[model samples]
Target: MIKKFLLTMCLLAALAVGGFLYVKQSVTDFIAQPLKIEQPHLVTVERGNNLNTIISKFVDDQWINPTQFSTLVRRFHPNLTQIKVGTFEVLPGMTFEQALNTIINGKEYQLAITFIEGSTFKEWREQFKQAEYLEHETDGLTEAEIARQLGIEHDKLEGLFLAETYHYSVGDSDLDILKRAHRKLDVILEQSWASRQDKLPLKNSYEALILASIIEKETSVPSERERVAAVFVNRLNKRMRLQTDPTVIYGMGDRYDGNIRKKDLREATPYNTYVIDGLPPTPIAMPGKASILAAMNPENSNYLYFVASGTGGHVFSKNLRDHNRAVQQYLRQLRSKK
Candidate 1:
């Protein structure tokens, strides 16, 4: 009877041990399994969000099982309070551990600022000011002062910053961002200048940039940049005025109330191409890579004049008579449409 009783006790103990082991294995598998998220998702933890709130978000987003997620968070990330708040890209099939580690490890969020070709400095400033992460304030610096801060000698920072989408950290300063952009522009310009076609009309790389700025302002169409550059190149070769309206607009400065009157065109300012010969004293606006390349290697043409075609592009001509005809055609089209 005593032997039978001991045997029964041993069997019961073995069964209990086996059941405990099975339960442990099940829990471990559940916790370790990768959570497969099908769609692209953004997880934003705003500043000062607590650990419970973050876990709730994960659970609600179907990113994790609540109990397993809570266990992992409590065990591994006891210091969940230290997680920085910002946006994070959540990839598919990432485990809770992996996501938690990513958020806690200070991975920077990249946001892009796209400066379109031919944008003025004023426009660029406004865009940067309006950016969510950037701090906006009254810039007490004059144009000259801003240039000085940027380490450029010219009063105009126009045509210096290359137009492209630049990535930045969450709270990068405006000055620092601009400086980095200028540095990038310098490197690209140097490379382009070195590989340029020889014996062009430009005196130097700066002169090339000036002409490129003109091309950028003249047309919004990518196909017309080279042609516009060609016209300006022909004029430069012949020592003729560029006669671009963009220059007149630049010369008007702050007083420019968005209208280019006949008198504005006729008025002689340093930047007025209609009134003065050769390149302007400074670039009117920033040029993009295409315009810069076009200026460097203009399409080989005898074109010396162009006028807006009222189709958001320009009509190029090789001589004065053809240019006048294009002007009349564009004017008539404009009047008829109005």
Candidate 2:
């Protein structure tokens, strides 16, 4: 009688162990099952979302038991309960476990905005106006008002922001992007000024920024940055008017209709370098790092003038006679093309 009772208890114990093993294997297989996404899909987890909310989506889509998924999450993957708040891209054929890992790891999708070198702050604002998913907090605000908010001392906000690609998440404001760019510009300008070449004729970093903006507008060719810098530097050293056309155009504001006449150059404005004795009152545009560095450390040259070459570059000249020849050559190229 005792031997029969012991055998009966042992058989029941064996059946219970087998049933537990079977349930564990079934849950593991369910977690490893591939998602039904035919293509890539974006999943956004907003604030106040938890494991239940996330799993509810999968449960609705896959016809899976929500209780089962929730029990597994609580038992094995408790980290999924605290997922990140951002947009996530889930690819096809990814398992539920893998997708949960992606959300928990928090590598959110990022969008980018690019500012062209030598582009004006107004152009940057226009880009922000057109960018998708970015909050336009700076929209309809004047430059002076925006400058005050940015803590800039003056209303002259040109060249204060750096030109580069800035990444942001959804719900980020345009002002947020500008803040980051401004901080980066400050660090770069401080570093460049600390290691600048001697006798650059720039009294301060702001002056360097102004000169850099001029250099940026002067040439699109990378090699010609130093050349353009030298021309402006030599003019500054000689106490001569910079006589740059872009400065004139900037001073003209919306009155500038593409063509710059002699009358425009002679017009007296704070930004008109032709009419001003030294650098402009403010930078003309947002200059890149190369132009900023060139302004701080110009090459040793006596180049006082430059004219656009026919082949998308500039011809530098030290004397007025040579500069006139290059100008004539540029006009001839334009006429020949016509």
Candidate 3:
């Protein structure tokens, strides 16, 4: 009877060990198995989202088993608080471990959008449509619509967004990109405006921006910007019409053909400096940092007019007579060289 009892105890011990090993194997397989998804998904963790919120999102999306997903996530990723707050793409066949790594390591796929300086609103809209984050073949939103969505007024948007590369996730709105660009511009402009010179002719920062835009369009040379600003300042002080060719181009509006004809000059328009005195109604284009600084602190000079020399630079003159003479010289030289 004692031998039989000992044998029964050994059999029970063996059964317990087998059960423990089976449970361990099942847990390992569950952790290793990929979660199959029928469609691609996106998850956004807001700036203040916590670990519980993120886990709940996974469960709600049916991407993980709610009962075991949290335990699995904690087991694989000890640093749950390190998960980045941003939009992430959730792909099919990704294990719980892989998803955790993707969020923690910032391995989320990004969509890139590039805005080139000097692009018009229409042009920017076209480029936005081609972005990977945006839906293709959809009727695109207008610039006004985008600005409205971003809580920016239409008039305040021109020349507001800076040119740079931007990143977003799939299905990001056009307004989202505009807002990002505008925010960057706002910070840069504020910093620049704070350091501006005192006693500038511009009534406000906007006027300074307008002058800078003119300087930007007038010349591409960094060294010439201050000189160009000086010319405009002299004209403004003397109460003479700016007569900037770019202003005339702006006056022609969307009707402006490829050429700047004599008729366009004679026609009266709000933006036509040839006809109207002082600055134009608005800026002609976005100015770079160099141009903005030049407008704020123009070089003091007697130069009242400037004409493009055949070279990349410009020829400045103190008076109309000198300007005419310089024009003749430059034009003759250009003809002779050709």
Candidate 4:
């Protein structure tokens, strides 16, 4: 009777050992096998999704063998029932283990969009419209309604969103991106406004933003920003017409045929700083951080006029007579080039 009992125990132990060895080999083989994907596959694990759902999704997509994958997960990572919510990219020829690890680690597949400085709000909207991954919530909303939706109380929406490259996951809302940029602008505007010099003609931070946008449109050179800002500041202090061609072009709208004519300047519009006093109603384009800083801290200069120096920068002057001379020089340079 003792021999029979010992024999039974040995047989049971052998079966257990055989089962363990088989499972170990199966797990190893499953993990080592590459996923069947010709192109990169995107797997989105939403919140509240379980391992079963993930496995089913992969199986349905034919990314993995359902039976083998289930066995491997059950034996190796039984506690990994829920994957973190994110979109993971499973590249072609990656091993099953590699793809699974990427999903488990929640490495999101990020998309990027850039808003260029000096680009108008219209251009910004066009970019948002073209972004494939962004969910368009504010597409049909009016500009004012869009501002309200973004939690901004401003009457104007132009130059409100900061220019920067923003990263987002798939299915992220465009409104969310706009909100982030707006908040960034708010933070930067406040910090810059707090550090501004005393007794400036600007009424508020928004006015500074407007000036910054003008400066941004004026020049791309880093060294020229403060000088150009100083020109505008000097003009504002003297209650002189900004007479900036950019403002005139902005006011001319469809009438501006790639050139600023005498009529365009003479035509009265709210945006035409030549006709209206002080800053325009709103910013004409998005301003970068450098422009914003330059607007707040303009160089101490008596200069009131600027014309393109033909070297991708501007030449500033203290009076209209000098400005006219600089303009003549600019014309001579243009004629020479032609």
Candidate 5:
């Protein structure tokens, strides 16, 4: 009787092991099967989302059997408790294992934002605020507070970020993009300063940044950038006011009615180059690398004035009489347009 009982116990143990092996193979096969979706599907992994939630979504969509999928995940990625936050694209024919791997690695979507040259810091912030993919950590913070958080010591925050397209993942913060732009600006500034032409009227790299911002706002034409910088450099050398109209518009702030008149130039704001002796207290707009390079190495010319030449470019002049002629030509062109 004892021998019979022992033999029966061995048989039961063998059957249990066989059943476990069969279940394991079935789960593996389930994971290896093609997904149910006919087209590509977007899977958004929100921050702190549990693995079960992700699985449940797929299960609800009839993409996979929950029990089999859970068994497969346990057998394979047993330690994976959370998915990375981002927009992930799951292809129609991908196996469950491939989809899981894609989610875990966070390699789904690439997002980009551009900060345009000659745009103000305010505009850059507005763009950041409007971006849906980026996490807005700087939202509702004052300019000073935001600058402080980024460790930027500039009294005025305008033009601190570089003008370029920054790429990031979905879970990235606005501060991350800001830091990237700031670092890029810092790198470019140092290089420009190190290679700058000698005896420039500007005091330091910060002043170069200020001049670069002015140059960026002066003209959009690539050929005119150095000429514009040269005009400003000449004015600085001759102790003439760097009377650029963009400076007055910036100084006017909320009061500028899309026009500059005698009073705006006459107002003694720190940014009003018509009233101030030298560069503004801060950069007026974000400058690109070309503008910064142009500021550092202005063309050797006698040009001290520039006016819009009816076209998108400028008419540069060396003296008041020529500048006046250019201004008259600009008026004639405007009259013709009307």
Candidate 6:
């Protein structure tokens, strides 16, 4: 009877070991199963989501079997159960274990949106409407209301945001990006103003922003920014009307059909520098760092006027006579091209 009891105990121990190995192998196989992915897509693991809930999402979506993949995380890979909150780019051919590891330890995918230099706030808003994975909370809000929310008392919002590439995750808002740009512009503008050259005609950082916006619209060549700034600065010191075409365009608003007419220039508008004596009511466009720096410290030159050279640069002049000649030259070049 004792010998019979010993044999029965050995049989029970063997069956237990066999059950443990079968479970371990099953978990390994399920973890190695290829994830179901037909096309690339974005997946967001929201806050307070656990591994079971996440796996259930896959199961509900028919991407995996509930019974085949559930026990693997808790029984074998306990670390994968500590899933993180992020947006991930799930691609084709990833295994179940790889996807979990990506959610747990891999870096979240980042998308970028760029605000081009010389763009207006309206243009930026239009871009916000079209951006993917970004929340549009500022839609339908007026500029004044938006400013109040951003803690700004400024009358207008143009040229407030810096022109640069900003990165964000799936859940970020347009206001979040705007706030960062505004803060950065504030810091940069303050630093530039504090170290500005003495005797500048600009009264404050706002005026610098206004001038910088014009400079940004005037030239795209990197080498021409300082010289272009000098012409505007010299005109400001001489009390000459800015007579800039961009200001006329801005004043016309939707009436501007990509062409500036003499009648449009003759019209008296607050933003039309040809009619106004000083900088416009606000900045007309977003200016970059170099343009801001140029506005703060212009090159020391006698230039008072400039005209586009048709070759992607400008012909600067110190007097009306030379400026008129350059204008005539530019007209001739246009005629020759035509």
List clash counts for every candidate, in order: 1, 0, 0, 0, 0, 0
Q: Candidate 2: where is the Cα deviation over 4 Å?
A: 1-30, 59-73, 76-82
- Candidate 3, residues 195-304, lDDT tens digits: the string is 77766667877777778878877888889999999999888878888888887886686897878888888789987888888988777776667777888888978899
Model 3 quality (TM-score): 0.67
lDDT of 2: 0.88
lDDT of each: 0.78, 0.88, 0.74, 0.87, 0.87, 0.89
**Candidate 4 deviation (Cα RMSD):** 2.4
Rate residue 172 of model 3 by lDDT. 74
Residues 50-157, candidate 2: write the lDDT tens digits: 777778887887734444435665566565566888888788978877887888885897889999999998899889999977999998899999988888887978
Q: Estimate, for each residue in 13-109, the C-alpha lDDT of model 5 and write its tens digit.
A: 9989898788777767766777898997778888777677787888898987666446355655565555777788888889877887788875767
> TM-score for every candidate vs. truth?
0.73, 0.84, 0.67, 0.91, 0.81, 0.96
- Spell out the clash pairs found in candidate 6: none
Task: Give the clash total for candidate 6.
Answer: 0
Q: Model 5 residue 142 lDDT?
A: 86
What lDDT is reached at residue 199 by model 6? Answer: 95
What is the overall TM-score of model 5 with all chains considered together? 0.81
Which residue window of length 10 is worst by lDDT in model 4? 66-75
TM-score head-to-head 3 vs 6, winner: 6
Candidate 6 versus the native: TM-score?
0.96
RMSD for each model, in Å, please?
Answer: 5.7, 3.3, 6.0, 2.4, 4.5, 1.5
Task: Choose the strongest candidate by TM-score.
Answer: 6
Model 2 residue 61 lDDT? 77
